[model samples]
Target: MSKAVRAVALVLGALWTAPNTVIGLLGGVAGLACGAQVHWRPRDLALVFDRWPWGPGGAITFGNVILHTGDALDVVCSTYAQRAAPCADPDIVLADHERAHVFQYMALGPLFLPLYLLCGGVSVRNRFERAADRYAMTGRGWWPWP
Candidate 1:
């Protein structure tokens, strides 16, 4: 897509997910006071905070904001991914998985959270998480299975 078109799409996506984004921003604000570092990735159209020191030792994405427990976004989330096997894809990264969530929240808006919980919360059995991993591994399939 052209830059202008992509920019407009990004604005609309961010707006669509604004409510959750606000919550994520609030968490980030709190994390900042606790020594979390934040950065904006223009390519992903997302904000990422690292060393947030919360959750299950990986990362969680709310809308386009990602809070990662680690100091970087490229590591395998073995402690929290809840998968049956270790990731074998050398090119796959945790940031890609979180970015898939950015799209999921953009698509589902506020309903995403409740539905995510209903779908099994943080388990790898969760379709949302499975889809995110799919995207991370294959660079496609971010939508939860029907």
Candidate 2:
């Protein structure tokens, strides 16, 4: 597997307890390049989640997805990697996958999550995953997947 592929797999493995929406690794600097607007370290993510009453993860103002679990990636859910994962224009797989979520949010507008939960999320999530994979394959040398 490529670096991007491995990273994605590693991130997905860490994030999914229910297989709802796994957005992949949070590459800090890289994530910023990719449009992630937060300035967070791995420890900060852990602290927030560990200390928070609601749970480990929650959505940030700019659409960043913060997973509270240890080593959990902080992602920008708006742009690529939801503007969370670090990559100034990620590898093909990463960008494509992340962008798919962006598109979904665009299509659903404000009602994305609520509708997603009500719609048996598996289908939409699967569709987005497939979108990333497909987009990655066709993206040429855009993202090395590493």
Global lDDT of each candidate: 0.84, 0.36
TM-score for candidate 1: 0.87
Once fitted onto the true fold, the runs of candidate 1 whose alpha carbons sit more than 4 angstroms away are 78-82, 85-91
lDDT of 2 by residue, 1-146 (tens): 89999667545433432122223223323344544443343422211221122322332111123323223233322323434356444334333334334334433445556654564453423444435444554532222122
Local error of candidate 1 at residue 94 (angstroms): 0.5
Pairs with backbone N, CA or C atoms under 3 Å apart (clashes), candidate 1: none
How do the predictions measure up, each by TM-score? Answer: 0.87, 0.30
Indicate which candidate wins on lDDT: 1
- Judge candidate 1 at residue 146 and give its lDDT: 56
